[model samples]
Target: MTTQQDPSRETVDRWAFADTVESGSPARKPGVRLGPAIGAAAAAALVVVAATVIPQIRKDPLGAARGTVPQTPTGAPAAQAPAGQAPVGQESLAPQQTPQGGGGSLTYANHAIVGPGGACCSTSGGAWTAAGTGGYPAYTGPVRTSADRNAWYEWNLGRPASGARWDQIKIRLWIPQAQAGAWVRITVTSTAGSASNVATFDVAEQEYQGWYELPATFTIGTPDRRTGSAWVKLTYLRPYTDQAAAQACADGSCDRMAAAQAEFLWS
Candidate 1:
């Protein structure tokens, strides 16, 4: 029992502006802060003292009950690691978990820019296309303009080849070096209505330049909404030009907008 509060933890938190603390419960420690939730009275109860020091803080001169500690090399509040303290901040980050064969996952054959065909650029209309380019085993197309039809596809997740519905459709894709910073929208249409999920890549993240399952598991349609509908169609919206597709062949940095080995994920 000491009269002094921890110098580092003696902070007046402003209405719980405390996102910096990591997960896992922090136990009551002498210097460690229990946070603002604990009122001043509760916090005051957590002090420790050397054997010779008096338990009463008022009786002790200066609140040095914890003893004279060395100053931090910098004046900033530094993290003090007490003996056997497990390191903080082991966050359970968003998962890009690989789909194992049996875990609520189903396979849906991709309709747009299917893979393992090899890299080549073509044009169906004003929209530029890359069926198989660079042997990357995925689609990589960048929009030559902000047009709606530049890079687009409509694939149906037909009434469950295996069952009536599934957890979600898993689309496997790879973001190549050239495909960095590409924006795309995925829209799913079913009996109820259409829902659109959009995402963009600014850097080569976890699955960048390599085959990776899209971070999100998408719903073709909900059970009620899916009843009358025959199947769910997923459309990719991106704009590109034929000229741009040819240019991509010349340039090594190609923006891949295609996916490979699409499947329905089941529970």
Candidate 2:
């Protein structure tokens, strides 16, 4: 015999079938999550969006390569976070920089030259005196008395490549036999534009004799810093003897007995 189904029972069976299809079968279990596929698709879309946007947000390499970092329209680094913190590609600039001064000691030697100029006058030229052979011009005229004494010679050394710093100077002088025992004086006066700067030294009467070597050391009176030429003058302050001995070249031109030698070292 055929039986008729109840409406409520049919409806409940269809609902149960749909729930199983949507969730899971009774023999099996559901997964830990149901949205991983959607999540992965969303992540891929995000990557595409970043790829399209990052280039626009990044700094221009051309400007950075030229050392002129690209800036925002507001005159700040385009990527600066906020504080003085450097932008993305500038980690190497953290260290800072500063300048540096001079040193070392300098040394020099002393040298001298004599008879650089030719000799003039003969023994018979004047009062007539005899200067030994090796001596240039023979001594002539009366002995140099206190009234007739002058002891300086001046010359030009031209432009100096390395001018003298004047730490120390050694002067070697030669006086006539008649002038021996007289006070030998040496004065160094600046002949450059500033002539008033002068240095003076007196060889005592006791020290005055034939062939004397005087080493006078002095600090250079401030540097003149004058680039051009300068003159050096040496003068004798006092005359040695009071009487006029025969045939003395101390007064007149004496290539023989009167001469001066000097040596110096500078920094």
Candidate 3:
């Protein structure tokens, strides 16, 4: 025979039966925690967010902070100036670039077509004259009447390719009936800049008459810079004779040098 159950106890028994039915699986233990499942879901969300954010940081590190974006200009010309011109100078106006190639070219902001400097001779047409004979329009490679009688010829070699290097220079000069050899200096320099690459040639062979290429090729330019302005100086290492006096005569005037062209070579 069954005993009659209390009403409050019967109520508690019914609630426990409901919880077991909701869980459904008999293998599921009671009082298991939901906190681990919630934590795992949050960690997965953080990984997804990081994947999207890292690329943005790399695309532009300062874009977010600077509030400005950098973009490559569209439809810009490959070269600013025409094929045979250089940009306006940060200093003076550079001359037009020579259109021809094969390495012999001059491009400068402002340049002097080589002329004779210092007092030593007379110039007429394309030759320097001293004594009774005339030499090619050239500076008198003095024989040394004094310390200041050296001859210097200068020309403005245009600026080099923005980053291009000044490799070596090939120069052509003439020496007429010489009693002895003199010292010739090829100096690649910048205006108001110290001497860059300087190469010297000794013309000892009196047989080296007429236009002869300097047997010694000069490698020019300062370190990583262009040979700003190019100048050539001729001084006597061995005393032979000075001709400037014969050309200067009673007047201190002289003629122009039209033959001296110092070339710039680039890689």
Candidate 4:
């Protein structure tokens, strides 16, 4: 009993004696205290951790609380049109072009010799001859006479493009000054039996000698597919006079009544 008590009491007495002797005062509690350098280093480390974690939490508070990264929403791409095709609601609405010419106009040369209603005119006596050396290749017809007071010249303009709407019709002609009071009537007819209004051109009103343009409003139907053509008829309607009869045979030449070309203008 003496031996066991002595051993335990000796251990406790030795720790108390050493603390009291080293400090030369009452023994202090056994604990650790931080030095100035270590305390500052620990405080800086805590500041660095707070700075890094606080920004992350501020940027995405819910994500930081949930411990997950935030996700962004993505949108689908837009639709595109096929190659060589127009986009929807952006299709072109321009009028179709003609084969003869472009720029909203169609030109045709007058070369046929047949008149309207299959009526034949005498071409043996040079009544209808090419107006050679007259700038444009035109055909000259004899002046209207008592016997042949009405001469209808026809031009077979080929079929216009489908749905073509011509606003103006033009004819190029040459009328001599001697036929001052003579007149010509222009009309358009299709093989589909559609006809336009009569357009009259009077020499007395125009006073044109060499080349002149006769324009008219075109409001009739377009060319038909039946014959694939439109007929432009120029009727020379003038009462024969003694002066016209004398001037017709002057110098063995008929008065120059020529038609060169015809045109259809688009709106």
Candidate 5:
């Protein structure tokens, strides 16, 4: 499920100061000048013009012109529309133990993005560790991001763990109630090597009410099976996005705990 907090409805209307005409007030009649009579008439005409235009200018107390208002990133009024896509309002999808079509082995892994000195940019969750063979690097609890949007918590399913003949699979997740939209992304990959085969999906924010329980599934089609890679990777794209989104609902520390508990199950 995705969420959105509409600022217009939420934001308090600000008070505006009324404007005064810069030119002299019309109450001051044409001054008696040392010059000719024509000069006096010209001064009177100027006052008439100011009187006409100043009233129109004062009509727009906020300084905005007719038919114009500040807009959002996408050409629509920022006050009325959300940035990028429209806000998601539905509940999170429910968890399902059984895969859509059924029958497959499943494994789970956890990762966080806290880097050197613990900046905590995108990382979430508690400590994580793995045990396996075939030089498959078990994804340690917190993965690091280098601006590539490509940090992953990897898992392996070689001969012993996964039968070589099984050609189809599905992946699911336990998304936190708080990070419904702002900062979370989901991605899947077919290789542990540098040039990994991959797929990605974006999660959006949801409305405020109750926590969301979403279960997402993806099919490993025939083509992916033909490639012959022995490992799979699940990544939390832009974990910071998740942090920010979830923070909207809860405190930063609370949000981190929520994200850490997020589960990734495959079948």
Candidate 6:
């Protein structure tokens, strides 16, 4: 009678034979031979599985090893801007500067020509022949004239635009001929109640001839004074002297007067 061998022992033997074949061993045991067809089918199945899984592993080896794709933490903070810098799309809080005027020559709104003896040259200074004739409105003392005669060219500058402040004020004068110790006094008045601001400029000798600039300074206040109240006066002080009278009135023509031009700066 054939003895029924242990089933567990047979299974162990079959596995041991398969391990030997995988290790390149050509030896086989009697009655424990594996079928050639079965071995080929198993190898084909392994090939199909390797073909499908190896490409995926090659694509993402780290993810395959970790068994999951890497991800950012949901609670991580976002990037921030540098210190003292505004964020994107944020409005700036710093003050901005807006400058106005100073484009061209400044125009006068009102003018007055006061001749010697405190007399008005015309009913309106604008109607005078020498009001804007590009010549200085001046009077010369005759020889032996005792009184100190003076002439004035008063002008009112237009008010600065709303929300604008004065930056600088400059006056240009053309001195055709020069005289010894000849000078003009410039006075600026902002309001009726405010004191006048004065500056003296010398226009004597050849060095003082031609175009000369007279810079003047005055306080317009923090909020500025009332509009249409600012004015400037150019006074030609003619003192009676032998030398001045002889030189100025010798040719019967006092060409020592100046042509005035003014410019205003604002911001």
Error of 4 at 136 (Å): 1.9
Report how far residue 52 has shifted in candidate 6, in Å. Answer: 92
| Distance from true location, Cα of 167 in model 6, Å | 5.4
What is the descending lDDT order? 4, 6, 3, 2, 1, 5
Residue lDDT tens for model 3, 118-195: 232222222233332223445343321112334444434444445333444445554543422333333333232454
Backbone clashes for every candidate come to 28, 1, 11, 0, 15, 0
Candidates' TM-scores?
Answer: 0.31, 0.32, 0.30, 0.33, 0.27, 0.33
1-267, model 6: which lDDT tens digit per residue? 111212122322211112334567777877765699988998999999999989888987753555443343674444455777665345445545695434333333323322222332211122212322322434231111111234455645454454333322334444434332234455555533443343444343223544455544333433233233445555555432344556654643342333343333333
List, residue by residue over 4-59, the lDDT tens digit for candidate 4: 11112232221111233454677788988999999999999999999989888788
- lDDT per residue for candidate 1 within 141-173, as digits (tens), equals 332221233544333434443342333545444
**Top-lDDT candidate index:** 4
- Give lDDT per model, in order: 0.38, 0.39, 0.39, 0.42, 0.37, 0.41
What would the per-residue lDDT of candidate 2 be over residues 1-267, giving only the tens digit for each residue?
111111122322211112334755578566665398988998999999989767755755343444555687898866645477654554434345552222112333433323223232111111223334312123322222222244444322333344344333333444444433334445544333333344555653323334455444333332323333322343334543434422443443322223332333333
Residue 109 Cα positional deviation in candidate 4, in Å, after optimal superposition: 16
Quality of model 6 by C-alpha lDDT: 0.41
Look at candidate 6 and tell me the lDDT of residue 120. 27
For candidate 5, the per-residue lDDT at 149 reads 32
The collision pairs in model 2 are 182-240
Cα RMSD for candidate 3?
31.4
Badly placed stretches (over 4 Å) of model 1 are: 1-125, 129-149, 164-169, 174-181, 190-207, 220-261
Worst ten-residue run, lDDT, model 5?
Answer: 130-139
lDDT string for model 5 (1-267, tens) is 232211123644444445667986668668665568888988899999999878878988654577787665697775533454433432233344773443333432222222222332324232432212211022222222222233343333222233222243444333334322233444445442233444555554233212223333333333213233323233433333444455454543221221222222232
